[model samples]
Target: MVVLKKKEMMQCYTFFLLIIVVVASAIPTKADDQKKRVKEKSLSDASHSEDGEHNNDYDHEAFLGKEERQTFDQLSPEESRDRLGKIFEKIDKNSDGFVSEDELKDWIQYVQKRYITTDTERMWKDYDISDTNEITWNAYMKRTYGYGDAGEPKEGDPVYEYRDMITRDKRRWERADGNNDDKLNKEEFSNFLHPEDAEHMREIVVLETLEDIDKDKDGFISVEEYIGDMLSDQKKGEPEPDWVVNERKQFTDYRDKNKDGKMDKHEVMDWIIPTDYDHSSAESKHLIYESDKDKDGRLTKQEILDKHDLFVGSQATDFGEALTRHDEF
Candidate 1:
């Protein structure tokens, strides 16, 4: 009878041992399944990111790229805008709302950015007007564009619908080139801000746009390597200098006024034409009022075109006289 009891106890112990083993083996399998699920979810998230639907916030530091972050940090936005403005105004002819596509190309070349030939594919995507490989002011001021003017938002604006400085810029661009001209050719534009004014304005804008790219301590930008860099997702050098970074931030106050991403012409100009704003000649202003039959203080396309030749001839004469004076001096 004792032997029989011992055998029964052994069987009970055996069953318990088997149960323990099964539980132990099941625990590992369950844990592994959980881990696999988590890993698969992580992979799915990564795939979603690669599809480009992610809404990552603007990372200016990362945008600066490894090579330029050091220099970009050194200069302020004010200095950058000041420098770029000088270059832009110098090349801009019509003092109009926008720079012509050709002028912009020249500027890119001047800054050492990659150059796309006039006839290259999508070359005119930035400015093409008639599908004839030409650019027009109307096209330049496309309301849908980030830089295009869509007019101003008045007081008591809605929370989401309030227009900002980009809107103003678009409106300014449209108003400046009202004639639907293909481009602001050299003769059509002039500087609203002359040497001193242009200098101040340029400093303000350049600092904001091209800050910290000056690897060399020299005031002027040595190269325009940031075009490609800006388009990538890379970490730049150490933090930019306080002054240089400050200028960039300050320029953003104006360039990105209203919290929009780009600038338009309205923010750049005032209604008063400069006394020195010689549209071909110093005498052109005299004809401005004469042409405004409606007396609204603005010249129409026909009116400006009517005297275009006269203005051209007067300017030529003035240029000659100035040359003669310089020779005499």
Candidate 2:
């Protein structure tokens, strides 16, 4: 059996959560084709019924909970600025004039934990039919697959509607059974819903990313492969964006450590999970760059309010929402 030290396990969890945040906030591109296909399938199911009976009530597009969906809607500039100011104040814990790296990191972890806890509780309630505070694989599959105790889906069942969920959750169950006990305790269930909390799951994600980007199937990502998604024009034959050109240069110059022409697994892993990386520091610098007007490397509450537009729709701008929905988590 493979054994991970406690500190190593914590690092894996942190690295996994950081990747989740980055991927969540990243600008969508053609490289997300697989995700796009899944999304498109859900949308298609929502719009049309195979049996010709329109089931528009099924909201296949809903990813967020009721409150989260409400909060995700756009706000006017004035309202957004007001909201941003409150957010900055909360993150600047200790009533400090500037947010420190520790403060920023704490805020990020808080947000991520809130999301995971909310999602996990929701799933637990759904599968825990006996109110026993634990879920067996049988109960989970029955609820998710919409099957009865007889071990099969009923006739006239909308099996197709849940095919994706079934497939995804079945794999999740296998991975979540960490002790191979065929059941998930509350903690394990949480890890099941949010795999970033499970250290072993991170390797799977890294491998998937490698497979997705290694276009030539040579076990490494070339410079072209690294920037392929960014370089591709959404409108055929159009020139790539200037930012894409800069990114291509960045990958070759900075990311290609040791002057290697290709990014091997270790190089890719470093690029994704840099050693001693502090997400808080990076986020703080970005906030200061956008809001600081005095050429200082810090932000005052007023300065944040003044340049709130820059932070809108960003993770830093929604502290209030995270707090307001705190009880749900």
Candidate 3:
């Protein structure tokens, strides 16, 4: 047995404490996992920032559809006008020679649908290990979670978060399987992956949001909870970024309408999935507002072509969906 004097023992203890700190620092924190979790925002949230700077890329992507985003960006002014002309014909579905709010809304929805369709096909390749038209829930579970049945790892285990995620995926999968055949077709899988974009899956999206931010499991999100979720990267005693501060204000002032110091299910629904606030509809109005030079309620082909820069990419074209599509516009 080794014996040490008091000072020597203290030095050994200090060395072990330093090693412990290094190991602890190497482990990823809960905040990191929280940040990686689903905080996916809607189109409206993506289009505008906290500082009110309109991100034209998001609007353009929404306007032109994800597939056409790069096509429009790299286009010359003349080329932009040419493509806009073709898209205009599509938007003016009734052959009315004018784009109404409803027509524009329909077009935007179509673009989003196209995005979902394309994205699902790309993602499906990885999950369809059986090389079939549909994916079974068991296959998904095995592929994603490395197990056919997620038998709850103890909470705080490294994989406990994955168990929670698997549970969420299963709930979403069931919702996606409208036919309840225990499998998902492409469309159903699209809805599963992008419940945020689907109308019928609104409740699941809201429920998931509540589950994520409602730390106390009180079925409501308090101000602290909202701020905490947004500031997942923030450490204790660290100062919040300006955007987080602005979001805190937005939550209190605009989000919590009843002023109960917290948000109930209804309030959360309004905040996340407001009945009146349709992303497609809002973008439609905004499109007309920006491009309708005639001051009329509808947009003419000439008007859209004139504002081709607004509708498509003028300056940069290598982001979002553009970079991935290797072929030219």
The candidate, 2 or 3, that scores higher on lDDT is 3
The segments of candidate 1 whose C-alpha lies over 4 angstroms from its true place after superposition are 1-123, 131-162, 171-329
TM-score comparison, 2 vs 3, better candidate: 3
The digit string of per-residue lDDT tens for model 1 on 53-103 reads 321110111111111122332334444333333433543557563344344
Better of 1 and 3 by lDDT: 3
RMSD of each: 32.3, 12.7, 13.8
**Looking at candidate 1, what is the lDDT of residue 306?**
46
- Candidate 1: deviation at residue 244, Å? 10
Model 3 regions more than 4 Å off: 1-41, 70-73, 129-133, 149-161, 179-181, 197-200, 216-218, 234-246, 316-329
lDDT of 2 at 210: 65
Q: How many residue pairs clash in each candidate?
A: 34, 0, 1
lDDT of 3 by residue, 184-228 (tens): 887887777777666777677677778878999989999889777
